[model samples]
Target: MPSTPEVNFFQEYWIDAWQRSILTLDVLRERGNAYVERSARTAPHVLSFAFEVVRDGRTLPRPVNYALVRIVPPQGTAIDSAKPPFVVVDPRAGHGPGIGGMKQESEVGVAVAAGHACYFIGFLSQPVPGQTIEDVCAAEAAFIEEVAGRHREAQGKPVIVANCQAGWQIMMMAAIRPDIVGPILLAGSPLSYWAGVRGRNPMRYLGGMLGGTWLTALAGDMGNGTFDGANLVANFESLNPANTYWEKPYQLYSKVDTEASRFLDFETWWGHPVLLNAGEMQWIADNLFVGNKLTSGEIRTSSGVRVDLRNIRSPIIVLCSWGDNITPPQQALGWITDLYGHEDEIVANGQTIVYTLHQTIGHLGIFVSGKIASREHAEFASCMEMIDLVPPGLYEAVIEEVNEGTERPDLVHGKYLMTLEARTLDNIRALGVNSDEDNQRFATVARVSEINQGLYRTIVQPAVQASASDRSAEMLREFHPNRLRFASFSDQNPLMGPVKGLAEQVRANRQPVSPDNPLLSLERAASAWISTCWEGYRQVRDAATEAIFLGTYGSPLLQSMVGLGTHHAPTERRVARDLIREADEAQLRIQLQQRFEVGGLPQAVLRALVYVRMVQRSVDERSFAMLQAIRDMQPLNDRMSLPELKACLKEQFLLLRLDEERAVRAIPRLLPESEAARRAGFEALLEMLGARGALPDEAARRLARVESLFGMNAQPAKVAHA
Candidate 1:
């Protein structure tokens, strides 16, 4: 054959490289084709799991494009209906819905495999006409209500896993109707938009760089009252041009054979852009991004109800990563410091805030990475029931892989076990936050945005609408660069029609070079060189952006012009203390003190758990497991549901907080006088707190004090079954 005639090492290298180039182009073609096919589907979600439609938001009182679907458990997986259902709300930031369940190993997958009834909140490609962000929030609440109604027999309300954009949306809904929602896991949700470090987080400076949300309103006007999501996706891509423009495509080119499937799968979702109403995007831009009003209590419902983050009654579990430049731990957690001056305020409001920080996962990895799903998310599923029953205060979630030293390995469901350690507001502050000056800079941006938006509505918006027609808007969206890049490479292009057949032929006679080939290594080095250059460019661009933003917005002239007289961010921007809530808190503390000694073994066990937790030595889920065992031993009707367990735990924790000395002294009174009954509980609880090595004196003294209080000796017994 012609190829056999030139069978040499150099020739092989040359042939392989050429073949790979074709294959890479072909892969892109396939990806483009997939985008087209997905767009044509009736319901084009990328969820690997099959699901049944529950309720359509289009049919709701306030119409929207969202739909709630119940995921069918995968084969060999059994769902327990009595357990609370897990509802995953997808983000509509840019791409189409289903990032949370795109793969088999995802949030929905974990919940389904764990035997929980799982539901997905997905949306149509287009928003319903005249729908606003408020309408979407209302629709979500109705969906949650429907989910709750379906699971009336469940021991707990539905656990909501809100992803990215959905994180803030679901929080708004939960704040309004916490009764329908259960514990909420906000994965990669940026609640405090203005929270970031100076040199590191450059995205927050974008609003100022663009002169505020005027561009957002212009984009919507150009689209005939709808905003193309491709713009949002383009902004995300602009963050790392090296990865977006080169590394991602080169990855497919370098390993086209094995990576094609995965590349296409991801692009299937990322390539298909959705649409949002102009009003919807404007509200999000004004209130959340540039305005940073979500946590500031400035955003209210259409009916005049305040959608306060502090009003969310469910447990708020924040999952973010240090590597996530998009939604860093600061943005995810800064709201705590914004709302509460001290940790006691969180407790006073009956709020349980748990945050988990990952060391090196990117923003997408927080949901899409299989490793994260297997570890952090898996652990959350295992501990969510316990999470519901934990005290109302701030806590840090620590998930450790099951090692040899891990106690009660049998109790752990998967490869990891999760522990919730009590944390203070200062701990959250330790993870760098915006200073007063930084806050003013952002507040300046918000003010300028308001002015710019008003000017556009007054001067330019009408003219833009007058000239823009539906046909022109559709044409503009069709030719959007993000969408065109993919569409231009598909079969619709006459030039790409032959790529399919040529690629098929190349596959038949494929000659992949050996891994150690010197020429291939040279090619890899060249690709890496190009990637580094792009990365350097991005750094320079980011630096310039930061310099321009800080210089422009930090001007005292601008501050005074914005009506910030003292050049200080208004104190009222921080959550103002509600006099009514302060009175309720005072009454709450008094109520907690009165319930010093609650009834029954469950109440006694909860009190002990809170007491050991206060010491913060090493009491963990093993103690929580023991609590479950005790519940199992109780009579059917006598056993508490999640709501009752939560009430008992909060009461016990508050009792300890109001008066620890009295609460501890009365522990014996709460427990049964029967020596065997109390001893079993003590042994079960103490087994978890005992140190493997020599215990610290403080921990040891607390241990001794607790043992004495429980009427047991210093030597802790083996963990006895309930």
Candidate 2:
């Protein structure tokens, strides 16, 4: 090892180098200003960029404009029919479709490279007058129906990818029409709205800090009908003052020559904020963001049917990132904890849920980063089959690297394979820095929201709505601070014409600073230091806000005044079964019998072995071995001669409630000469006799007589052990 002094000398040298690399405050400010000007100039072109068009073969009664953007292939070549279909639903929060697939290496592009048929769910620039969320959902359903029809010629259902605002919306559509969805993937979406850890997940604190969403209502009314998208973008930017003030600008200045185009492209979308109708924004705030009614199983369609997530039969894949302060993994995964409370509940409900958490990817990166797209999204698209094969359960998606020499796909999109590990909701809860006490704070927020909304409607909404008009709305959109930047940069300004010429000249001779340059290094150091300081300031401000809010409003007296005294019921105890093991064994047997009737011996045995492995310690490997042995029998080939054996196995599985089709399928797995076949048949017969749910004694005897043909004797030791 090197001597301590030598190591210290190197460290000291690097520190000095870093100090020398810092950029002057003036230089940083200038760099940031240039980026803003450039971005503003390019805003229109970026916002107006069109998604490559695609035609759906399955048409609807009314024309639902559909597009197919070849995000990776660049729009001319045909896609392979064998690849799975990936459909990206852009958030309708304010902006439209394509954000999820804006770049060539975006979510859609990643799926296309992985051999998936890519589809974009893009809407018209204008929303239909009086259109409700239900109408939008119906349109989505029609789109899914069309996609599914086209995919009937291929294999597997289409994977629907929903981002941010679209996540909950797509989930709502899936909850109502599960048959249309294969596996649902949600990114940067928060389903458990009221769920957050104290002093963290500040976005959740936004609703409370704003004193409720009446300002949103007022804005919508003032705009005549629509809520400006600039407000939404402003809210997002407000999360980090350092980024809004210095860091983002400094980053552009540090790499101005190379990064200007990229910065302009993103700013185009960022500046081209869209609008949402008054009723739409109101509904979202009341039912989702603040009300927290959707996940509570309280949200219902206008037609009266309840929207329960458990009603969705399709697999759900939740992708969240730790670095996404906007929608933390806690917010993304907390719904599972809130909804089911445990893994057993999920399994019992026959739902397969898989969640993957990226340690460092930010919110936008979950949908926009090519690296994330190639690895995380690609693995998910490639492994739908493997995931489907995973029997109904709750699992954490674990990614692992494979050797380059292995028989992996050539040019694998990702460097790793997606694997599933059984997980309980408690496991998810542990990842969150939340307590039940923290959730109590949300109850207070919700109560305050209701009162504020009521107060606004009663005291202020009438006047706000009465004075609004379409012209005013347009003017409002034009003058908004977020939009003003773009407007001021446009060709409409006389100064912009000169600035544009200068920008072009700068582009020609821009002597971009090198990453290795000492000055560039110093700029980065300074930016980091500033960001750290800003973060500390933000933390203290938030702490003080939270302290004040809790001190006065969190008290029982104020909680009562705010109508927040509706006591939370004590959490119910988990049911503890008497003879739990025996019951589980019996249940397993019946489930197997049902599967034997429906699928076959191989499937039935495989399922039983799964449960056997799950319930019994040290039995997993053995049960899996048995499953393989059963699969290798090729019982289908000798079904005619092994009818008796087949009947026996069928009966045993029926006792387990495995499904009738499985029993019939298993008929072929038991060969005439196999000794194990006879024993398997015998056990199946006993299961059938015991599983007759409501048969009379005489009827039971008759069934038992039929089962006796295969000897309904259980190995006494096995029954006792069970």
lDDT winner: 1
lDDT (C-alpha) at residue 370 in model 2: 77
lDDT of each: 0.84, 0.62
Give a tens-digit lDDT track for model 1, residues 1-722.
35553356678798988899889889989888887887787668888888899999999988999999989888889888878999998999888888889887899988888889999999999889999888888899888888989989898999999989999999988888877889999999999999888778888988888889999999999999999999999998989899999999889888998999989888988999999998899889888899888888887887898878888888999999999989888898998998999898898899989998999999999989999888888788878888888878888988877799875677666777777888888999999978777787888898999999899999999999999989999999889999999988989899998888889999999999988777788899999999999999989999999888888887889888988757353534578767877898888777766678658766776677667557652335666776677677767897787678878878887787788888888887888879898887776566444422234555566666777878887565342321
**Per-candidate clash tally:** 0, 41
lDDT of 2: 0.62
Model 1, runs deviating above 4 Å = 1-7, 565-573, 617-619, 671-722
Predicted candidate 1, C-alpha RMSD: 2.9
For model 2, the stretches where C-alpha displacement exceeds 4 angstroms are: 1-78, 404-414, 504-526, 566-601, 604-722
Compose the digit string of candidate 2's lDDT tens values, residues 502-617. Answer: 55454454444334555546657878899999888888877877776566545777567766554754222122232543466568655554444354433333333232223221
